[model samples]
Target chain A: QQQVKQSPQSLIVQKGGISIINCAYENTAFDYFPWYQQFPGKGPALLIAIRPDVSEKKEGRFTISFNKSAKQFSLHIMDSQPGDSATYFCAASKFNTGKLIFGQGTTLQVKP
Target chain B: EPEVTQTPSHQVTQMGQEVILRCVPISNHLYFYWYRQILGQKVEFLVSFYNNEISEKSEIFDDQFSVERPDGSNFTLKIRSTKLEDSAMYFCASIGASTDTQYFGPGTRLTVL
Candidate 1:
C-alpha cells in the first residue's frame, strides 16, 4: 500500500510565480515529514522538514505547510526560478519505524 | 557539513554474479541504512544497521542479501547471485542518532544483465 500519495505527476510554473505540490498520508502516527529534492544522476537531498508540532516551516523561498488533522502537507516555492527545476519527493516517518514512506514524486519545471 | 560517501558510482554485472556495494558514512554517525530505487520509482528501504548488527530490514531484503561493516569506516552490501531485478540505484544513509535526520550519499547505480 502506498501510505503517502502526491498529486501532479508534473508541473510547470513561470519564473517568479508560485509552485505548489501537495501530499497526503494515511498514517497518523507519522510525526516527521520531510521533502527531498533530487537532480538527475544524483541522490535525493533534504530540502525542508517539519514536525507535527509545527504547522508551517519556511526556509528561504521554500515553505512547507502542514495539516496534521487532514494528514496532508504541501510545499510552496515563492519566486520559483529555473534553478528550482527538479524532482521533488515527500516522505513521512514515525519515531519507531525510522523508515521513511515516500510519495510517488513530482517533477517540477520552472520556466524562465 | 558531514556527508556520506559511496564508492563505484556505477556498477554493471551479468546475472548470477556477485556484487558488493560500499559506503562510508559520516565519521561521527552511528546509525546506517541502505535504500534502493528502481528507475522512476520511489526509494525503498532495504535495511538498517546499528551497533554492528541489523536493527531492521524490509521484506525485500532476502537471504541473498547481506550487510557488513568490515572496517571502522566502511559498510558494504553483498548480493550473492544477483538477478536482473536487482538493478537499481542503491543509496547509503547515516544519522548521528536514531532520531536524527539522515544524510544520504550520491547513490551507486547497479545494472544487471
Candidate 2:
C-alpha cells in the first residue's frame, strides 16, 4: 500500500508539445505529493508538488494535477524542450513523517 | 539556493568492510533523510531523521545500517559490514520547516565489490 505506481516507462515528445506522466498510490494517508527531475548521474531535484487539498498546482511550465478521490496525480509539461529530457519521479509522503515513497520513474525524451 | 551536499561522489569498498556516507543538508532545514536507488530502480526510502532522532526507517534499513548526527551540520549513514548488494546510489535529503519540499544531495555512489 505504500507504493506509488507511475506509468509510461518511457515517453517521447516533440518540441513544443505536451508531455504527461501519471501516478497512483494506494496509501490514503499520504497528504503530500512531489515530482522530481533527475539528470544522468545527478540526484533528483524538486520540480513541482501538490497537496491533497488542492486539485492542481502550476509553476511556470510544470503543473501537477491531483485527484484525491481517485488517489491519483499527474505531471504535465507544456512546451516540452530537449532540456527537459530526463528521468522524472513521483513520490508520496505523509506530512508529519516525511518518509517518501517514490515511483518507478519515467524517462522522458523531448525530441528537437 | 541552499541545497544538500554529500561527500565522496563515489566510494568503492570490499565486502565486509565498513563504510560511512556523509551528507550536509541545507543549513536551516530541520528534517533529514536517506534513500537509496539501485541502477534503473526506484528510490527506496531508508530512513528519516527529525529533531536529531530517527523518526522512521524501512525494512531495508537493517541492523547493519546506522544513522548519526554527531554534529549540528553533518548527518551520516554507516554500514557496519558492507556487502555486494549494498552497491547503489545513496541520496541524502532535507526539508525545511515546511513539509512539502525535500531537497536532495548530488548522491554518493557506493560500489561494493
Each candidate's fnat, listed in order, reads 0.56, 0.83
Task: State in Å the error of residue B74, model 1.
Answer: 0.7
- Docking category for candidate 1? medium
Q: Which candidate is the best by lDDT?
A: 2
Q: Which segments of candidate 1 are over 4 A away from where they belong? A: none
TM-score of 2: 0.98
lDDT of 1 at B72: 97
The 0-to-1 C-alpha lDDT of every candidate, in the order given, reads: 0.92, 0.95
Residue range with the least summed lDDT across 10 consecutive positions in model 2 chain B: B94-103
Q: Write the per-residue lDDT of candidate 1 for residues A1-112, one digit (tens) a residue.
A: 4389998899999999999999999977888899999998888899999999999999999999999898899999999999999999999988565688889899999998
lDDT measured at residue B91 in model 2 versus the true structure, 0 to 100: 99
| Residue lDDT tens for model 2, A4-33 | 999989999999999999999999999999
Query: Can you list the residue pairs that collide in candidate 2?
Result: none
